[model samples]
Every structure is written in C-alpha cells, then in structure tokens.
Target: MISGLDDVIAAETMLSDVDGLNGRLVIAGHSLDDLAGRTSYEAMLALLLGEFLQADTAAITRNLAAARREVHAYVEGIDAAILALSPIEALRAMIARLPDGEDRDTAYRLLAAPAVFTPALLRMQQGLPVIAPSETLGHAADMLAMLLGTVPAEEQAKALDTYLVTVSDHGLNASTFAARVVASTRAGLTSAILAALSALKGPLHGGAPGPVLDMLDSVGTPERAEAVLAAELARGERLMGFGHRIYRVRDPRADALKAALQQLAKAGAVPAGRLALAEAVEGAALVLLRQKKPDRALETNVEFYTALLLEALGLPREAFTCVFAAGRVGGWIGHAREQIDHGRLIRPQSKYIGPLAA
Candidate 1:
C-alpha cells in the first residue's frame, strides 16, 4: 500500500485543484489569484457551493448572518470548565453540539459556526464580554465587529475577506480528506464538518500559524534573522514557515496573504517594525533553506503571513486555526456534498506484512 496514500487520486472533484508542481491553486474554474482580494467571501462561498446553492449568493449571505446569530445559543449557559479551554478547543466543543441535518441550511449554519463561535470564546477566555453578532453587516465585518466590539476599518475587513477567499479551498488536503471520508458514511453535514475540524486540529495541518508568530517573537529583529535561522537549521529543527508538503515552489496562498498584509501595513494597521522583521526573516529563511537542503524546494508557505495578517487583525495566536476553519468550512461542505452525491464507501484495503497468521 502507498504510504500516506501518496499520489492517490481518490476523488474526482470540480471544486478546487492544487497544481503543486506549478504552484497554482484553482477554485471552481478560477485561479486563486483571480479570486483572492477580488471576490467577496460570500461570493467565494456561492462559487464553491455551486448548484447545491441554486446560484443564489444572497441566500448564503442571509443564511450566514442568521446562522452567526443562531450559534450564539451554543455559547450561553455552558459549563465554566469548558469555557476555560483554549479558544480552538472550546470552539470545537461548542460546534460539535450543533444540531445535525443534511439540508442546505445545515451547511450554511455550520459554515458560520467557526466565525461566530471563535470570537465569543476568545473574548470569554480573555475576561472580556462577548459582543453579540450583527445581522446587518457582511460576514467579515460582522465577525470583526463581534470580536472587537466595533466596526472594523474597511481595509481590515477587506484583508480578512481576501484571506478567507484565498484559503476557501485547495485540492484534497488532509482536513478536506477527513471531511470527505465522513461524508462517505452518509452522515449529516454537521458530523462531516466535525470530522474535518478534528483533523484540522493536528499540528501538521492547521496549527503552524501560531508557531510562525512564535518564531518571529523569538527572532525579534530583521538584522538577527539570518543568524537565528542559521542556529535553527544547525540544530536540525524544521523552520515553521519555510516549507510546505504540497507546493514545491512558493505557496501561492503565501503571496496572496503577503499582499494583504502589505496593504494593511501601508494603511498603518500593523506595526511597521514587525512587518519589516517578518519580511527579513522570510528572505533569510529562504536563502538558508536552499543552501541547507539543496534538493527540496522549500519556499515560503501560507502560515508565514497568516500569522502576521491575523495578528494585525487583533486575533490571538491561540485562535488562528479557528479563523482558518472559518474560511475552510465552506470548502468542507462542498466536498461533503460531492462525496455524498458521487463517491463510494471510501474504504481502502491494506496488506499485512507481519508474518502470516497461522
């Protein structure tokens, strides 16, 4: 059997394609560049859901707004112990409690859960009052408002909207695969999305952005970047933002987010020094990686700028993956529907090599 199912073409999907060799990501017949920052998050959702959504972008916007308000019910009256868990864990615990269904609304509701639940849990963890959701604002603006208790600046909201669109879908990555496997069981949308969240919690998948910030904090200055990266390389530690498993060249998502972060920096949203330090670290890490590895093309990937962008938007590092989930849930729902309509049981066979049983 192929280890980790490498090079396996398990599903035929029209949702998204990751052209790893070319370092391009296509979502619903459009390149990631074509969609990032250019399309609204609701527009990206409509594009991904396709016929399942009846070509109605307005319906999704309404459903997500309503669902964001609805999911607040999950945050109230919870155990104090559960409230004290990290934001991601608490958000996951709360989301899994959502009522399951296979209706179109079910997909819409689950898609809104991370956007709504993450900010509430974050405020609670930080000893701040949870701001209620706004039914009138668009998804990104409403989410930022709910978290920070005021409307977000247009640039801030636009940056987050770009991030959401850029990451909405990629090929059959691990969490998406987990989502489809659960979908193959004829499970409801809630169950399938919960399965995706479980996989996303792993450090290798959706957990690196937090550490990218950690590395930046540790490095602190642009002038020290090369030395710090050299020490990390000498110790054989994997650089957090320098490599990707799929993209042999630079991750296109990295460029998308970096562009957003640059825009935010130009608007004076992010501290100037940190952005400069991050850029320096990125250049130093790329040079050192090529020198050390020689064979593998380990270029900058998504988590590098993801940390800076989310940090600029005032999200805590602990809550990074939840924000990622907020973007990715739409993709998960699309894959689940595809699997349900067109996939088989998803059970793969394995061979035993440990001496034959008597």
Candidate 2:
C-alpha cells in the first residue's frame, strides 16, 4: 500500500484539475489564468456548480446575496462567549449551527456561511458591532463592506474576487477529499463541509497564508530578506511560502495573485514600498532555497502573494482561512454533490502492521 496514498487516484472529477508537474490549475472548463482576474467570484461559482445546478452568474449573484442576508441572523447570535475563540474556531462554531441537507438551498446556505460569519466574528472580537450584509452588493463587494463597514473600492473588491477564484478548487486536496469522504457516507452537505473545514484548519493545508504575512512582518524590509530567510533555514525552520507539496515549478496561482497584488499597489490600495519588500523577500527566498536544497523544486507558491493581497485588502491575518472557506465552499458543495451522484462508500484498506493478539 502507498504511504499517505501518494499519487493515488482516489476519485475522478470534472470540477478542477491540478497538474503538479507543470504547475497548472484548471477549474471546470477554464484555466486559472483565464478565470482569476477576469471572472467574478460569482461567475466562478456558477462555473463550478454548472454541471449539477442551473444557476448562471446573475442568478448566483442574487442567490448568494440573499444567502448572506439569511446567514446574518445566525451571526447576530454570536455572544461574548463565542468571541473568545480564535477566528477560525469561532467561524467553525457558527457554521456548525447551520442545518444539514442535500438540496440546492442547503448548498447556498453552506456557501454563504463563512463570508457572513468571519467579518462578524472579527468585529465582535474587536468590540465592534457586526455589520450586516448588503443584499444588493455582489459577493466579494458585500464581504468587504461587511468587514470594513464601508463600501469597498472597486479595485479592492476585484482583488478579493481574484483571490477567491484563484483558490476556488484543486483536485482532491486534503480538505476536498475530506469533504468527499464525508459525502460518501451520505452525511449531507453541511457535514461534508465541516469535515473539510477541519482538514483545512491544519497548518499543512489552509494555515500557511497567515504565517507568510508573519514572515513578511519579521523580515521588515527588502534589505533584511536574505538574512532573515537564511537564518530561518539555518535553524531548520521551513520557510512558510517557498514550497508546496505539489507543483514542481512555481505555482500558477502565485502569478495570478502576484498580478492582483500589483494591481492593488497600482491603485494605491497597498503601499509601493510594502509590495517591493514582498517581491524582494520572494526573490531572496528563491535564491536561498536553491542554494540550500538544489535537489528539490522549492518554488514560490500561492501563499506568498495570498498573504500580501489579503493584507492589502484589509483582512486581518487571522481571518485569512475563513475567507478561503468562503471561496472553497462552492467547490466543497459541488464535490459533495458529485460524490453523491457518482461515488460509493470510500473505505480504503490498511496494512495492519500491529502485532497479532494471543
């Protein structure tokens, strides 16, 4: 048996393809390069759900806006006690309160939960009242409005939309696999999504982006990048954004988000010097990684630019993964339904290496 199911084809999907060797990602019928900055998050969601659901971009935009308003009632119940947990934990706790189902309405509710809950949780923790979601605004725009209590600039909204689309799905990842396994058991979409969120909570999965920002904070400037990164590597600390388990070449999503970050910088949403420091750190990290581990392909991954993009868009680091869920929940729901339609009970075999009983 393969350890950790390395290179195992667990399931076939029409949703997204992750070509690790070439560092390419395709969602539904579109390449990541085509979809990221050009397509709206609502449109991406429509594409992902098109096979099983009939909603188009406009329909999705309207339904998702309504879903946000529906989920706000639950956000209103976040007490002082719930505010004590970390943002992801608080987000999880709130999501757990949503009912389970296998229908389209249920799917939309699951899709809207994180976007509605995350900003509210952040506000509550900061002793600020949670801003209600606007039904007229689009998904990314409304999420930004909720978080900031003001209308987001068009460029900022577009940047967040790009980020969401860039990460909407990858083929059979840890969390999406978790979602499918739970779905295989016929446990309903909410259970599947919660399982996925638990997997994403692990640092190896959805946790890296936050730490990339931390690394940037530590590096402080372009001149300090090499020294800081080299020191971290010398101490055997894995550089947060330098490598990915998949992708032998630089991740294409990294390029997608780097472009978005540059746009934000051009629009004056992010400082030019801050963007320069990030670029310097990325350049230095690549050089140091090559010099240190010549055998491995430790290239830039999505987390590097994801950190900068989200920070520039005004999301605190702690809420990064929550926002990730907002985008990925569409995929989770789509994959859950796909498994329900075409998959069976996912019971894999074990080698049973333990000693025999007497």
Candidate 3:
C-alpha cells in the first residue's frame, strides 16, 4: 500500500519546484530570490509562458491588457443587487461569465478575468462602483490605477509587481492541483480557472493572509506580542502565518515580501518599526513554538509577509485574497494550458473503508 503516498512523484514537470526542506523555490530555471526584486510581473509571466506561448512580448502584453478591459466591462454590468455578496462570491460570478475555449484568444480571456474579477471584488467590498480598465497602461500598473483612479507611485508599482511575480506560480498547490485536474479532463480554460478559484477561495488555500492582519491588530505592539502569542498558544491556537503545509524551513516568498516591506518602510511609506516589530513577534513565537512542539517544524510562510506588505501598501484586509487572485491568474492559465496539452483525465481511486453491501 502507498499508505498516504508520502512524497510520491506524481508527474515530470518543467514548471517550478518547491524544495520544502531546503526552503527554496525555482521557477522556470531562476531561483525565486534571483527573480523577486529583479523581474517585473510581465517579465516573469513571459518566462513562465515562453515555452508554450510563442507570442511576441508586445503582442502578448497588449492582448492581455485588452482582455482585462473587456472583462472590466463585464464586471461593471453586474447588477448592483449582486454587489452585496462576498468578494469571493462576486468574483466567482464574474469568472463564471467568461467565455469558454482553448484557442489563442483563451489566453486573453484568462488574463482579463483576474484583472476584472479582483478589482470588482475589492470594489464590491468597499460598496463602490467598479472601475473599467483603461488600455493606456501596462497590466500591473493599470490594475492599481483602475482600483484607485490614479497612477500608482513608483515603489507601490514595484511592490505590486513583486507581489504578483512572487505568487504567479507555485508547483501544484491545492488550487493549481484543482485546475490541473479540471484541465486534465480537457475542459475549457475558463472552467479550469473557475475550479481553481473555487479551491483558492477555501480557507485552507487563498483565505489565510487576511487573518494575519487580525493577528497583528490583536497583538498591537512589539511589547505586547509575546504575551498575546503566549496566551493564544496556551489556548491551543495556531498562529495565523507561522506554518505552511509545504515549507518546513521558511517560505522563499516571505523573504521577498519582507524585503519589499522593509524598502517601503525605509521610504516612510509605512509606519516605522512595524516590520521590526513583526519580526520580533515572529521570532519570539517561533522559538516558543519550537520549545512547545519539539518535533514539528512550523516556520513562517508567505502569508505573514503578504499581509504586512499589502497593509503597508494601504490595502484593506478584505482585499488581500483578491490581490492574490490578481497575480495567480497567470499561473492558473499556464498550468491549465499545460494540463490540457499533456492530455490526461485526472481520475484517482480512493481506498474503500466502508463495509461492502451483501
């Protein structure tokens, strides 16, 4: 029996690798650290989709932006009555309306869906009208610009770019796995993305980062962090950002976001010493956690710094997961394409434990 299939090699891949034990990640031949502050989200997307998408960079960028514009129109047309729904629910509705297909145009559809869906979700949460996308700017810049109705600051743009690139792809996470399974059935690209988003909406997947802010609010200050954390631990609570299912050491993306947060803090874009305070809390909590658990390795993951960085960027907590979806749309599309190209119906058998009928 494979008994839990511990470390079972599922597929041969060229997408990305997650070395959990070593706390490293490589995407398409570049280490995450090398690419983090170095490449724009558009550049990183080109790298991930290059082997499969042969379109010219300018053409792809234009197509993607156009797609975003199209989806923005669709989102604006959604009834105001529906605006009262949860952000994720509203996003799901918008995505559900996307056209179905796998032709060259499908790439544009995938690109547009996230751009429209995420902003619409954010606006709905704020009880504001969703803004339509403008074709005049780059995709990442346009997203921030549309959401705020003004051109983003240079550092803000850079931070958003880093956030998007860092999260654009990860090898076969739960939502990506769901996407792959759907794509493996030769489903339409939109269907695959919808499935992926459904998975991502779940608490175990993309719903974590918002809670990190709550944790910070509860702790309130560096001096109070240890006492709050100690009490929370005593109550058998898990710290919001302290553990990941994959990385035993530390999430590579956390460091990247931490660096971005530090830069933003230095530029006086955020409160002074907030990052340092978070670090102190995290360090104290980790040390105390290790002493308590003794056997399990529960290190900080991407959500920790994700919350801090987005907070510094002045985004509300409710918008955190929507922001996540904005970046991950590319990876979802790429993986869906790869799964479709590979052509397998992802059917797996489960061990039967219930009694058989007579």
Candidate 4:
C-alpha cells in the first residue's frame, strides 16, 4: 500500500491537473497562466461546473451573486460566542446553518457561504456592522466591498479574482480528496464542502498562509532577511512559504500571485516597501535553501505571495484561509458532483502492522 496514498490515482476528472516536476497547473482546459489574471472567478466556476453540469458564465455569475445575498442572512446568527472563536471557526459555524443537498441550488449556496460569513464574522469581531451583499457586484468584488465597506479599485478586485481562479482546483489535494471521499459516500454537496473545509483547516494545508505573514513580520526588513532565514534554517525550523510537497521548482501559483501583487503595486494599492521586502526575503530564502538543503527543491510556493496579496487586499491574516475556502468551495462542490456521477465509495486497504490475532 502507498503510504498516505502518495502518487495514488483515485478518480478521473477533467477539473485540474498539477504537474509538480514541471511546475505547471491546468484548470479545466485552460492553463493557469491563461486563467489566473484573465478569467473571472465566476467564469472559472462556470468552467469547472460545466464539466458535470450545463451552465454558462453569465448564469453562473448571476446565480452565485444571488446565493451570496441569500447566505448573508446566515451571518445574523453569528452571536457573541461565535465571534469569540477564530475567523475560520466562525465561518464554519455559520456554514453549518446552510441547508444540505446535492442539487445545483445547494451547490451555489455552499459555494457562496464562506464569502458571506467570513467578512461578516471579521466585521462583527471588530465591532463593525456586517455589510450586506451586493447583487450588482461579482463574487470577488462583493467580498472586498463587504469586508472594507467600500468598493475596491478594479485592480484589487481583479487580484482577488485571480487568486480565486488560480486556486479553484488542483487535482486531488488533501481537501479535495476529503471532499470527494464524502461525496462518494453519497453525502450531499454541503456535507462534502464541510469535509473539505475541515481538511483545509489543518496547518499543513490552507492554515499555512497566515504564518507566511507572521514570518514576514518577524523578518521586519529586507536587509535582515538572510540573517533571519539562516537562523531559522540553523534551528531546523521549516521556512513556512519556501517549500512544497510537490513542485521541484518554484510553484507556478507563486508567479501568478507575484504578478498580481506587482499589478497591485503599480496601481499604488500595495505599499512598495512591503513588496520590496517580500521580494528580498524570497530571494534570500531561495539562496539559503539551495545552499543548505542542496537536494530538496525548497523554492517559494503559493503561500509566500498569497500572504502579501491578501494583506494588500485588506484581509486580516486570520481570515486568509476563510477567503481561500471562499474560492475553493466552487471546485469542492463540482468535485462532489463529479464523484456522485462517476465514482465509487472511496475505501482503501491498510497493511496491518498492528498485533496479530490468533
């Protein structure tokens, strides 16, 4: 048996492919390079959902916008106790209120839940009123508007959209696999999405992006980057954003987000010093990693630029993973449907190494 199911192929999908050796990703028929900055998140959702269902970009966009408005009501139930928990926890609690089903309607609402709940939870935690959703705006734009109580610039909205589209799907990742496992069991789309969210909450997955910001904060400036990273390496602490379980070279998503960050910087939306320092730290970390490890490809991954972009988008670091969920939920729902349509129950055998019975 393959430990941790490494290199195991469980299901066939037309969704997304991760090519680690070559550092490439394809979502549906589009290359990540083509999709990330060019395609809207709604359109990306349309592309993924089209694999298993019939929906156009405009219809999917309109439906998701309406669903966001519908899910906004669930935010009213986020009481003081819920606000006391972390943003992701609060988001999860609110999502549990959504009705569960495998229908297209349920998929839309599940896809929309995190976008609505995350902003409201954060606003309420900061003693601010929850901004209602806008039917006129697209998913990424409306999320930023609700979070900041102001319409974001076109560039900022596009950056968030790029992020959503970039991460919409990536083969059978931990969360996606978890989502598909529940889906294969005939669990509804909402149940599958909740399983994905639970998997994403683990630090090894979506929980990682927050700490990328923390690492930057600790480094403080570009000049101190080498010394700081060297110390971390010497202490045998893993540099948070610099390595990947796949991708022998740099993560392609990192380049996608770096381009977004650059575009945001060009628009004067991101602080130049912050961008410069992150670049410096990234350079330093790459050099140090090559010198120290020599055998491993500990290049910068998605988390590095993700931290900078999300912070520039005015997301509190604590809410990073929630936003990640807001993007990935579409893929989760689509994968759930795909499993329901064409897959069997996911059961793998274990090579028993425990005590033998007579």
Candidate 5:
C-alpha cells in the first residue's frame, strides 16, 4: 500500500491538470499561460461553473456580484467575537451562516464568501470598519478595495487578478478533494466549501506564503540570501517556497506570478528593488536546494511568488491563505458539483492492522 495513498487514482476530473513532470497547469482546457495572463477572475469563474450550473457568463457575473453584497449583510450580523476568529475560521463560520440551498444562486453566494469574509475579518482585527464590497467592481478589485477602503489602481488590480487566476484550481488538491468528499455525501454547497476551507487551513496545503514573507524578513538583504538558506538547510528544515510534491521541475504557476510581479514593477506599482530581492533569494534557494539534495529537484513552487505578488498587492501575511481561498473557491464548487452529479459516495476502505485478536 502507498503511504498517504500516494499515486492513488481517486477520481477523474476535467477542471484542471497539474502536469508536475512538465511543470505545467491547464484549466478547463486552457493552458495556465493562456488563462492566467489574460482571463478575468469572473470569466474563469463563469467558465468553470457554467459546465455544472448551466448558467451563462452574464448571469454568473451578476449573481456573484450580488452575492458579494449579500455576504456583507451576513458579515454584519455576525458576533464580533466570531469575527475575531482566525481568517479561515472566520470564513468557515460566515459560510456556515449562509442559507443552505443547492442551486446556482447558492453557488454564487458560496463563491463570494472568501472575497467578502477575509477582508472584513482583517479590518475587524485592525479595529477598522469593514469596507463593503462594490457591486460594480470585479472580484479581485472589489476584494482589494474592501481591504484598503478605496479603489485599487488598475495595475495593482490586474496583478491581483493574475494571482487569483493562477491559483484558481489544480487537479484534486487536498482542499479540492475535501470539497469533493463532502459533496459526495450530497451536502449543501456551503458545507462542501467549509470542508475545503478546513483543508486549506492546514500548513501543508495553503499556509506557506506567510512564512515565505517571514523568511524574507529574517534575511533582510539580498547579500544574505545564501547564508540564510544555507543555515536553514543545515538545520534540516524544509524550505517554505522552494519545493513541491507534484512538480518535478519548477511550478508553472510560480512563473505566472513572477511575471505578474514583474509587470507590476514595470507599471510602477511595486518596487523593483523588492522584486529583485525576492529574485535573489529564490536564486540562492534553488542553487542550495539542488546542491544539497542532488537526488531531488526541489525547484521553486507557487508560494514563492505568491508571497511576493500578494506582498506587492499589500495583503496582510495573515490573510494570504484566505485570499487563496477566495480564488480557489470557484474550483472547489466546480469539483463539488461534479462529484454530486456523478452520483458516487466517496467511501474509501482502510486496511485494518491493529492486532486482530480473533
């Protein structure tokens, strides 16, 4: 038996392909290169959800924008203590509060949760008023506006869009699989999404980006990248952003986000020096990783540049995982619906080895 069920073929999907060997990702039949660089988060959401929900793009966009507003009323009614929970916990609570209806409108409402709940919780943590989502703004733009209490600049907004698109979906990741498992029980969309959020909160799944920023803070200068990485390597700690379980080569999403950061730098949205510092650290990490583990290729992965781009976008490190949930909820919903339509319960058998006394 494979430990942790490695190489287990649990389910077949069409939502996204994580081509780890080739370091590529395809979403809904489009290459990551093609989709992430140009697609709006709404467009991708419409595309992914349309297959299962039978809703047109216009309807999806309208319903999602409306849902963003609806979630605010939901957010407003929550107890302040509940809002004080950690980002993922707060998101799970707010989602549990949404009415349970297994339909397209509920799907839209579920998709809007992270976009609304994350920034609201962050603002509450800062003792600032929670900014409401603009029904007119796109998903990424409105999310940033709520976090910052103003309209995001065009370039900054576009960078956020790219980050969202890049992370929207990836095969049956742990979080997506959790969503599918819950949906297989014919649970409500909110229930399935809450399961996804729970899985995402685990450090192994959606928790590395914040620590990447921490590594940068500890390094403090471009010249120290090598020493810091070497020290960490010598201590036998796994580097936060360098390796991936699936990708044998570099992660394709990392390249897309790195490019987005470069674009923001070119547009004068992010400081080139910050981007350069990250690049220096990445270069040092890659070299050291290869040198130390010659048998394994622990190349740079998505969280490396995710931290950089989100930092440039001015997102708090604490909220990074929630922002990721904002992007990935679309994929979770799609997979959940697909699992439900396929009509199979996800009940896996376990090998019993605990001293049978028969």
Candidate 6:
C-alpha cells in the first residue's frame, strides 16, 4: 500500500486539476491565470456550479449575499462570547447555526455562511466587531471591504480576487474529499460544509500559512534567510511552505499570488524590499534543499507567498486560514452540490492492520 495513500485516484471530477509535474492548474475549462484577475468571484462560482445550481445567476448572487448578511448579524449578536474561541471554533459555531436542508435555497445559504463566518472570526480576533454584508458589493470585494471597513483600492481588490480564484478548487483535497463524502451521504449543504471546514482546520491540510510568517519572522532579514533555512534543514525540520503533496514542480498558485504581491508592491501597497526578500529566501531555500535532499523535490508551494500577500493585505497571521476558507467555501458548495447530484455514498474501504480477532 502507498503510505499516506500517495497517488490514489479516488474519484473523477470536473473541478480544478492540479498538474504537479508541470506546475499548472486548470479550473473548469480555464487556466488559473486566465481566470484569476479576469472573473469576479460570483462569476467563477457560476462557472463551477453551472447546471448543478438550478437557480439563476441573479438569484444565486442575491440569496448568497442575503445569507451572508443573516449570518453576519447572527455572529455579531454573539461576538463577545465567541471571541474567546479560536477562529476555526468560532467559524464552526457560525456554520452550525445555518438552516439545515438540501433545497436550492438552503444550498445558497450554505454557500454564503463560510464567507461571513471566516472574516467575522478574523475580525473578532482583533477586538473588532463583525461588519455586515453590503447588498451593493460583490462577494470578494465585500469581504475585503468588511475586513477593512472601506472598499479596497482597484489593485488590492484585484489581488484578492486573483488569490481567491486561484484557490477556489482543487481535485479531491482533504477538505473537498470530506465535503464530497458528507454530500454523498445525502447530508445537507451545511453539514457538508461543516465537514469540509473541520478537515481544513487540520494542520496537515489548510494550516500552513501562519507558519510561513513564523518562518519569515525567525529569518528576520534577507541576509539571514539562507543561514536560517540551512540551519532548519540541518536540524531536519521541514521548511513550512516549500513543498506540497500534489505538486512535484513548483505550485502554480505560488506564482499567481507572487504576481499579485508584486503588483501590490509596485502600487506601493506593500513595502519596497519585502517581495525581494521573500524571493531571495525562497530561491536560497530551494537550492540548499535540493543539495541536501537529492531524492526529494521540494519546490516552493503556495503558502510561501500566500502569507506575504495576505499579510500585505493587512490580515493578521491568525486570520490566514480563515481567509483561505473564505475563498474556498464557494468551491466547497459547488463540490457538495456535484456530489449530491452524482447520487452515491462515499464509503471507501479501509485496510486494517491494527489487530487480529479470532
């Protein structure tokens, strides 16, 4: 058996493809770069949910936003009490309150819940009140506006859109797999999303970005990057953001986000030397890591620059995963709907090696 179930092809999907060897990603029929800054989040959701969502685009957008507003108000009512909970815990609580059902309307509400809960959890971490959703705004833009209390500038907005789109879906990731499993059981959308969120909260899955910041902080400056990385390697510590499970080459999302970060830096939104320093650190770490572990292909993954980009966007380290959930919730809902339509329970057989019974 493959350890950790490596190279296991469990299911077929029309969602995003992760081509690890070529460092490429395709969402639906479009290349990630083609769709990143070009389409709005709602439009991308439409593309992913085509034929599966039964609702018209206008209805979907309106109902999703309305659901966000409803969840936002609900979270605000308990903001003080849940502030003591971790962001993921608060997010789970918020998701748990969504109305339960498998109807189209319930699907729309489930689709919007994570977008509302994640940002609210992040803001609550900073002692800020949750911002209500705006009917006048698109989902990604509204998320940024809510987090900052003002609309983001054009470049910032575009950057967030790109980041969100690039990560919208990947085939059978742990969280997506969990979502599909739940949906296969004919569970409601809320239950499917809660399963996905629970999987995402695991460190081995969606919890790498915050550690990227910790790595950057320990390195302190560009001059120390190589030495610190070398020492970490010597100590047998895995560099937090340098590798991925699927990507044998570099992660395509890394370049997508790095491009957005460069745009932000050019627009003077991020500090001048910050991107350069990060690039240096990444390059040095890659070279040194290759020399040290010849058998392992440790290329830079998305989390390396995801942290810098979100941090540059003024998000705290604690909020990185929550922001990830914000972008990924759309994909989760789409996948859940797809699994439900496919009409099968996802109960895979497991090989047991623990004990033998007579």
lDDT on C-alpha atoms for all candidate structures = 0.90, 0.91, 0.81, 0.90, 0.88, 0.81
Per-residue lDDT over 273-319 for candidate 2, one digit per residue giving the tens place of the 0 to 100 score: 88889889999999999999999999999988988899998999988
For candidate 1, which ten residues in a row score worst on lDDT? Answer: 73-82
- For candidate 2, list the clashing residue pairs, or say none: none
**Tens digit per residue, CA lDDT, model 6, 1-358:** 7886678877677877888888889988888878877877777777887566755567567767887776676675655667787877777877788787777667667667767777777776777776888987777777787888788888888888788887889878999989988888887888988999899988898888999889887888899999999999899898989888888888888888888898999899998677767877888898998899889888988898889999988888777777788788778887887788774897768889887887
Scored by lDDT, model 4 comes in at: 0.90
Q: Which residue ranges in model 6 land beyond 4 Å of their true spot?
A: 55-60
Best by lDDT: 2
Flag the better candidate by TM-score, 4 or 5.
4
Predicted candidate 1: what Cα RMSD to the true structure?
1.0
What is the C-alpha lDDT profile of model 5 across 333-352, one tens digit per residue? 99999898875999999889
Compared with the true structure, the alpha-carbon lDDT of candidate 6 equals 0.81
Candidate number with the higher TM-score (2 or 3): 2
Indicate the worst ten consecutive residues by lDDT in candidate 5: 51-60
For residues 297-355, what per-residue lDDT tens digits would candidate 3 score against the true structure?
A: 88888999999998887677776777788888778878888878875787777888899
Task: List ranges where model 3 is wrong by over 4 Å.
Answer: 1-6, 124-129
- Candidate 1, residue 23: the lDDT equals 94
Rate residue 88 of model 6 by lDDT.
Answer: 77
Model 4 misplaced stretches (Cα beyond 4 Å): 51-53
- For model 1, residues 1-358, the per-residue Cα lDDT tens digits are 7888899899999999898899999999999988888888999999999589775678878878888888778778556887888777887788878888777778877988988888888888778899888888889988899899899999999999998998898889999999999999988889999989889999999988999999999898999999998999999998898788889888999999999998999999999999989989999998999899999989999999999999999999999999999999989999999999999889988887899778
For candidate 5, the lDDT comes to 0.88
Show where candidate 2 strays beyond 4 Å.
none
| Model 5 TM-score on a 0 to 1 scale | 0.97
- Which residue pairs collide, candidate 6? none
